[model samples]
Target chain A: MEFTTSQVIEILGTIAFAISGSFSAIQRRLDPFGVLIIAFVTSIGGGTVRDLLLGDTPVKWMRDVNYCLLILVTSLLTIVLKRHRKRFTVTLFLFDSMGLGLFTILGIQKGIAFGLSPGICIALGTITGCFGGVIRDTLLNTIPLIFKKEIYATACILGGILYFTLLFFNLKADVAKVLVIGFIFALRVVVVRYKLSLPRFGY
Target chain B: MEFTTSQVIEILGTIAFAISGSFSAIQRRLDPFGVLIIAFVTSIGGGTVRDLLLGDTPVKWMRDVNYCLLILVTSLLTIVLKRHRKRFTVTLFLFDSMGLGLFTILGIQKGIAFGLSPGICIALGTITGCFGGVIRDTLLNTIPLIFKKEIYATACILGGILYFTLLFFNLKADVAKVLVIGFIFALRVVVVRYKLSLPRFGY
Candidate 1:
């Protein structure tokens, strides 16, 4: 089957998320099976959630064997390169950010296709972008980064808004998609580099 | 809208799970919003997952305002009864078991309706019965009880198998449902009372 550019980006995002999850599992000293499970959940959890909520099931991963193979291969690679854990930490951050940006746009596009309103679409986009990490953190017994002041979901929301705005003005679909993904990726990079965060509750 | 006995049982299960979630939130010293979120998630999380996996869109809760109202009232009641926490702990356990049994059967029934095989239906039943508490525990920053030595998911699986077995013998649907639910509820009660648990891996 011929793959589109969007499909290629989605595959890259899945690999990135899978690597991040594997790293978390290794750091937590989980067993091999645990590591694989974490990797699979982290890579596809968000998309699975979005599909399910949209009433699209058997889920995308179950429908496509390629996703499973990707996650499995990524997990194996991470496990094999455990000796270079320090080097991979940097890779993890980059992959995670890229995955977040790509998944957010994919989710927004899906919601729009489903004829949902802008606000709900934005919410779906945020959930799609950030929920994998949320599940990863939760399984590792930590507060989810998105629930903290990370500005993670914030970036997805902003990107989703930009997506709708561009479409409203009749921008080319490809241009809008690229710009939204770029915006989200850049925002995440800048926020982490500057150590910026939203204000937390005082009490 | 005439409601069937099965529907009533499902609503009761929802209320029970909501109360359990509210209790967990209050114990963890979560804010009011956190408490409400936990309650809502615990009450509907499993069924939402099942529906999503079944391609049943807008989710049952979105389609039914009564589920929301039920969870809201249950949360409020849990908060009001917080002063009687000691007494309510017992109530929480009872409700939790009841919810497990009802939800398990309901999930199995839905899977059968979808024409899935028995094994897949059993797995779906276990997920539907247990995932709410799993979500609640994860959000509260704890390992899920079902993943541990707890006989929770085991009970659901056993009950699901029994449900199919009864149907295979040409038993009535209502009778099968009731017997399966009773078996699960009883198993839970006995296991907890006897402090029984499955063996864990030494590694």
Candidate 2:
């Protein structure tokens, strides 16, 4: 089947999150069923939240069994790949970053399509980008990476703004999407590499 | 305003969860803002998930600003009430149990309204009853009582079954609803009183 650019991005983001979730679950030594459950949650978590907030019902995954099949296959592949791979942390981080960028852009576009305000769109984008990881980490009893890494949602928000700016400047929509995704992915990498974080405040 | 039974149950459940969440957040020493946020999540989390699954748009809280106002007021009331009371744990537990019963019945009725199968309706009921506390406990970084106690979702499931059975037996709808809710609430209390728990297996 011929796929649109948006569809391709969605598939890639889903796969990336599935693999990332598998790695986290495996690291926690969860059983296979637990790993698959986590993978499903991570892969669909963001989109589900975005769709629900937009009042788009039946959720994406519930309506599309294909996504469920894809996540299952990807998770199984991740398990097989783990046997041959020694470095999980770095690989997990890379796929998660890619998923974050891709999902964030998609969420922003969805918000725009829904006729929401720019601020609400950015919030939606950030939520779609970060909530999967947040839920996954929370389920695994770890501090969510968003709480530890300040730049996580910031990257999505800034990338969202950039997308709107690019659109305003007459950039091709396709080109703008790619640029925004690359911007978010690169921003996350740079921040993590430098261990950059916002200052902590006591409540 | 003439409130229907279902609306009354929804309001009571919302208030119960709001108070329960406030007590939890306060016990954790979170700021007032944090308490309000948790309260909102605990009250609306299950309903939001249910709405998304059933293709009910705008979810509950987003469409009805009154619910948000209710939760905010309830949370603030909880905070004020805390100053005059030294025993919060029991109160929190009681309210949580009541919320669980109320939400489970509401979810089952929604599922029935949607023409879902009995099994699916039961699952919806369980999810609607338990997910709020699950999210709340996860956010608080504590082991969810559902996982530890095992009776949480079980009560919802059994209660759901009882509701269906009563209807099948020609019991009045309103009477059945009240009976099921009371059964769930009382079951929880009895199980906790007896320290009943399912056996845990290492995964």
Candidate 3:
């Protein structure tokens, strides 16, 4: 089957998410199967939730074997790089941030395609972006990153808003997708680099 | 508004499911918020998932605040009954099992109303019966019961199929619902009491 450019980007986003999940599992000293399970759920759980919500038939994963392959390669890499845990951490975080940005845009676009309101679309995008990480943390018995990381979900919400704003001004779809992705990626990187965060409730 | 007898039965099912979730949360030693979250998810998650899949407008909780209140009271009772945990556990489980039976029937009825085929209806019903616990477990940071519990999902599947069979036999909707619920409840109880289980793989 012929693939669209957007589909190609989505596959990349999923792979990035899978790698992030793999690293999370590795950090917790999970065995390979546990690691694989975490990675698979992290990569697909959000999309599955979204599809089920949208009443989309045959969730995206079931429709395509490539997604399975993407996670497979992602898990294998983490297994091979297990010994270089420290060095892998930085790269994995970058990939995860990238995945978060891309996935959020994909989710918003897809929600809009199904004729959802902008509010709902952005909410869905936030879920799409951060839910995988949330599942990953839950599986590892930890508080989810969205709760702790502060900017994680916030970035998706911002990017999703930006995505439609650009579209409203009559920008092309590809341009809007790219702008939203870049905006989220930059915000996440800056927040991490400067140790910026939303204030905690007690604070 | 005139409440149907079936609506009354559904409220009972909801209460039963909520209490079951609360007891499980206590068993897992969750905090107050945790207990509330568990009870709410357990009681409504299955049906919510079913409605979303059917593309129904306005999810169930949005329609009625009573369901949310039911879960809250159930959680409170769970806390007060802490000293009688075992007895309450039994109560919760019995009701929880009953909730699944009723929910499976509910899902099949909705699917049939939507004009879906028997296979889809049965599949939808199984999803409705079992997935709430899956969501509850995922939230509570455990492997889902569906993966570990013997015959949990299979019972739902069998019961859903039987529901359609009764339909084919020209049974009235109400009669078919009761019969299927009985079948599921009996099968589930027998399996749990007798420790009967399906093989882990290749059913």
Q: Highest TM-score: give the candidate number.
A: 2
Best candidate, lDDT: 2
Looking only at chain A, give the TM-score of model 2 against the true structure: 0.95
lDDT of 2 at A151: 65
- TM-score of the second chain, each candidate in turn, equals 0.93, 0.96, 0.90
Q: Give the poorly placed runs of model 1, Cα more than 4 Å off.
A: A1-48, A55-126, A136-142, A146-203, B52-59, B62-69, B87-89, B148-150, B168-170, B198-203
DockQ by candidate, in order: 0.18, 0.15, 0.07
Docking class of 3: incorrect
Span of ten consecutive residues with least summed lDDT in model 3 chain B: B194-203
Candidate 2 has which clashing residue pairs, if any?
Answer: none
Off by over 4 Å in 2: A1-48, A52-126, A132-141, A145-203, B84-86, B197-203
Candidate 1: tens digits of C-alpha lDDT, residues A66-146: 899999999999899778767665666777888898899888878788777776677678878888998898888866766
Q: lDDT per model, in order? A: 0.84, 0.87, 0.79
Per-residue lDDT over B1-203 for candidate 1, one digit per residue giving the tens place of the 0 to 100 score:
89886898798889989998888777766655557768888999899889877878967775566787789888988787667656655666777888899999889989988999999999999989998988888777766867756599999999998998899999999988988888999999899888899887786
Model 2 Cα lDDT, one tens digit per residue, B1-203: 89999999999999999999999888877655567768988998899889877878756665566887899899988887675346777888899999999999999999999999999999999999999998899888888978876489999999999999999999998899999999999999999989987677787
TM-score per prediction, in order, is 0.61, 0.62, 0.57
TM-score-superior candidate, 1 or 2: 2
Which tens-of-lDDT digit does each residue in B1-203 have in candidate 3?
Answer: 88875786678778777877887788888889989889999989998877776667588888999888877887798678668656865765587789889888777777777777676677678778877777887777666666554567677878987877888889997888888888998998898888877432110
